[model samples]
Target: MKPFLCAAILSVLPFTASAAPSSSEVVESFIQAYNQHDVGLMVSHTTDNVTWMHVTGKKVKVETSTKAEFGAAMTDYFESLKGANATILDIMESGSYVSTVERVTWDNDGEQLSQCSIGTFRVTEGKLAEFWYFPAHACDELSLKPEVAPEVGVLQQTQY
Candidate 1:
């Protein structure tokens, strides 16, 4: 009976991860908020101490730990979403974490402001704790250039 129960639990466990959102849900939520240009929603899923990293040389460097700081960091990114669009290509899950491959393109008044980004996100505790992004390679000048752009307005942001 004990072995049978264990197998049942294991089989059902994988279904839970598949049925509902899992870590990938957290990332998808964040992207949804970003797509909607909502800053508050983006921060809601994050821990008080969130760590954000970029493929660029820039580092947020934990300066403080507070929701206001987190909100501020989100502000820096959200405000830039004048016409930003985030498209998720794929998601890879590993235990309590998920990696998402995505592309982001921002356009204003028929002119492309930034190129698409080849980005990845890490989710923890059903919240976004760490984010890593790389600029997607583009072919035309109309595309925005990719940079190591990690801008967390809030201070004391930690990496999970």
Candidate 2:
């Protein structure tokens, strides 16, 4: 009876593993798409109704939109920046939630602007269902020095 029960559990283990992409994988794909500035590819990894929340520590701004609306926003943002790129420094996953520390650099009419932030994402069914963004600094820590400070910062509490 013990051996039979062990066999049964072993047989069900594979099926019990989630069919959805791992939280790290989902975040990796999203970051890759973002680095390429491929809005379509980015949106493709999101649910039809995705909720994005930008938390400023003081207030939370929520935007619940369809994939189309999200895609449009991405397009507009890219256009405004001329060209932007993101680098994921670290990624941590817990259950279905993935959190990342990233630095984004953009050309704003030849003046480059770079900022670091923490982004938390909730992935469901292999797609992003929700996201929360928290800026690491209240103001852009701009520097023209040749040596740039490391972007990695301690993860603060998020409104997750």
Candidate 3:
């Protein structure tokens, strides 16, 4: 009986692992398509009503765009820029949402610029439904940090 159970579990393991793409995998594929300037591949990962919100690090300001609009903007950006690339630092997933920390660089004319940012994506039905971008500093402030709490007899406590 023990050997039979082990064989059954082993047979199901591969199927379980390949059942569906994780949220992180979907986001990673989108990022790879974006870096390659493959608009079709990037759009294939999103739904028709996909929305993107871009935060400019200003005081409570966000620019919103739809799937078609974002595609056009990305096309223009790729055409105008000399080169662009993205390096993913971390990826986290919870439920249908995936968040990534990335360093993105672009070359324009003879100058290069780079910035670190956090991108949060909502994937539904195996397609991207929404996304939000925030500067790394903003995400840093929101990150979980340990704070010394001498009074609680604890060496450190998580600060939200």
- Which structure among the candidates has the greatest TM-score? 2
Rank ordering of all candidates by lDDT, starting from the highest: 2, 3, 1
* Clashing residue pairs for model 3: none
lDDT of 2 by residue, 92-134 (tens): 8999999987888888777988788889999998999999999
Model 3 misplacement above 4 A: 1-17, 56-65, 136-160
Candidate 1 displacement at residue 23 in angstroms: 0.6
TM-score on alpha carbons, each prediction: 0.60, 0.70, 0.69
lDDT of each: 0.68, 0.84, 0.81
**Candidates sorted on TM-score, descending:** 2, 3, 1
**Candidate 1, residues 2-42: lDDT per residue as tens digits?**
99999999988877877556787778788898788787887
lDDT of 3 by residue, 70-131 (tens): 78877887888657888887789999999888877887677877777888999998889989
After superposition on all C-alphas, the RMSD of every candidate to the true structure, in Å, is 13.6, 9.6, 6.4
Note the residue pairs that clash in candidate 2: none
lDDT of 2 at 5: 100
